[model samples]
Target chain A: MRSPTEAAAGADDLAAMFGRHARELLRYCTRRVGPQLAEDVVAETFLVAHERRHRFDPSRGELLPWLYGIATRLLRRHVREEVRALKQVPHVPDAGYDDAAAHRVDAQRDVARLSAVLAKLPRRQRDVLMLYAVAELEYAEIAAALEIPLGSVQSSLHRARAKVKAAMSEEDNR
Target chain B: MSRTDPDLIAVRELPPGLAEPSDEAVARVWHKIAARPAPRRSSRRLWVPITAAAAVLALVGAGIFFLRPRTVSQPAFTTDRETVTRVIGDLRDRAVTAEPVSVGPGQVIYQTIHVV
Candidate 1:
């Protein structure tokens, strides 16, 4: 068993890890979901990471892959909840921001377009793409983070990449 | 062009532009975790049951004392109806005595006096 001092050091290391990577995690969340909910999702991801630090393998040279995995799962849940909520609401005209100039329609359009494409992908594929493209995890790291076989990671990533590319090309053609 | 060709690569992997977490974010998280009080000492929590039992015992003793029936002064009487009636009659016949009698369910005479 680790000594008390060692355990405390471990906890501090976890905190330092989170302090280092939280912003990137937030950006990934913003890309997967939107900017408005990114902070909450990132905070929740670190909370889980802190609570589950015992599960981490220190032998891994880096912690970002695991942290990204956690953030990916959280973003998935956030997006699903958002989509479910949207299904119940009627569409309405966009209101001007309280400041009237900051809430650009272009930003809203981009968010809407991304949301529509993300909502249609399989959950596994979406997770793979988000981790690889948005969070930028390597294949080996993604495999370790997801706890899946290496072969599975490669195939899933390939399928996810193909889907995202097709969707982007289709949007461009229109 | 083949889909995987380098020149036709539609998706570009940008350099990680991640910045350090804001001081405010770090401080907020650290403060929350640090402010959590240590687990209560086992000795203190162990005293809870013992203290509770002692309190319960004291309350029960007090309740028994307060709720116990009280002794009140009451006049003694004979059990024999015939003897009681004879004695009552004898007293009534002598000295023009007046004795208390029950006139209603809970009401009683206020005075028993002998008058000449």
Candidate 2:
């Protein structure tokens, strides 16, 4: 049994962690699954972190990747929802007539194409790609987050990016 | 390794109205994290058996206190000579003053005696 003081200290540490990382993590989840499910994913991530706080080793890596890893694992349960949301992106109406609006429409089109490609990616590759592109973690951090070899992270990211590029080029051709 | 790739940019750009999490959402999640049950340490686990053993010992002690053989204290009349003498005197006076009955020819008499 942890002393009351030790447990309090652990809670404080987790609260501090949440204060720092919750927003970024929320944004990341929102991108993977829409805003509706993002909050749930973020909440679960922190709860899992609190449950497994004893297993955390600061010497291994920073805390963000660890949290991302937990969120990523939890996201597996919603893979179908996420892919469906991605595939639906292109169909959403784009409404505006201003220059900024035109730019946004073009961006949305590009994003829609990327989302389609992302939906079809293998789980590991998509995870690596999202972590790289959205969370902006370093290769080492991605490795730590996913608990995979550094070389594996590198290769997965490479393959994921290449696939996105190829898909985008094919869209351009059409 | 340029982050400027259009596809990467597209991935980074969130859909309309999807930005940083609202304060309410963050607070809701933080509440959950804060409200989580604290992890029990090994020492805490030891309390269960320790408490149970203490309760068992207490029950055993209570059982011994209640069920053990006891020495009966002597009654006051037996312990005090004056009380015993007084009681005997009263019994004798009552017997001396008791009414006598005529016996029928076929009837048998039954008497109860108290030995001091």
Candidate 3:
């Protein structure tokens, strides 16, 4: 059990951690969502981590994976909010294809393609894949961040990897 | 390159030259983090002055309300000065209730019934 003093000290340390890692976390979120939504998601993620810092285990390898987990949760919430907001408007795109203008740059084209494929995956599978493949977190760390059984991580990772690979290949054929 | 292998481990990696948050983005995040008071310490510091000012004002207001006597509402006598002094003494002889209640600034009520 932590003393009140220890908890207070932990909050200060977490503030420092946020300052050092927020940009990297924002960059990571941008690759998942579009750049337009990245900063808001990053800010919300850290604010959440700050409020829940007591749950954070300092024994954990690095704080980045934990922040990624928070960012992933925020991204899902962002997507759901966007969907609800767009439902009011007419002519929703079939696959959430942002206009070509948004994907004009070569790198953004790749990101847009990848994002479209990612949007098709089940939420669980997309999360597992992003944490494992994009954030480069190990299976154990991903499980801890997600608070799920380790075996589930393995299964989700396999399914997500297969789907993304197939999608990429099909895109190449076109 | 095995272009046909869709089931292969696609090695999803960060693309080269992926867009990073600009220097401005980093600065904005840093400024926010820095602007926040180191958690508990900052919250404590922020409340101290506010709490102190509230307490001081409360004490000062209470002292002013209880200390001053109600002179404005006292009756003025048009009779002779001696008779007025005598009447004031007689009014003082009766039990006068001077309990203060809130009404407005610079005004009060004092009720005294002369027992004949």
Best by DockQ: 2
Per-residue C-alpha lDDT of model 1 across residues A113-154, encoded as one tens digit per residue: 444555666777767766766666777888877778788888
The global Cα lDDT (0 to 1) of model 3 is 0.66
Q: Report the lDDT tens digits of candidate 1 across residue range B22-67.
A: 6675455555545554334479778999999999999999999999
Chain B of candidate 1 achieves a TM-score of: 0.30
Instruction: List model 3 lDDT by residue over A1-174, tens digit each.
Output: 445555445555756666667777877676565555776677667777787777767565356667777888788877664333323223323333466643444334444555556666788897887676656678888988887889999999888877777767766675
RMSD (CA, Å), each prediction: 14.1, 12.3, 16.4
lDDT of model 1 at residue A170?
Answer: 58
Best by lDDT: 2
Which candidate comes out best when scored by TM-score?
A: 2
Q: Which stretches of candidate 1 lie over 4 Å from their true place?
A: A1-12, A82-114, B1-116
Error of 3 at B23 (Å): 1.9
| TM-score per candidate for chain A alone | 0.70, 0.83, 0.69
TM-score list, all predictions:
0.50, 0.63, 0.52
How many clashes would you count in candidate 2?
3
Cα misplacement distance, residue B91 of candidate 3 (Å): 72
State residue B54's C-alpha deviation in candidate 3, in Å: 33
**Residue lDDT tens for model 2, A148-171:** 999999999999989888978876
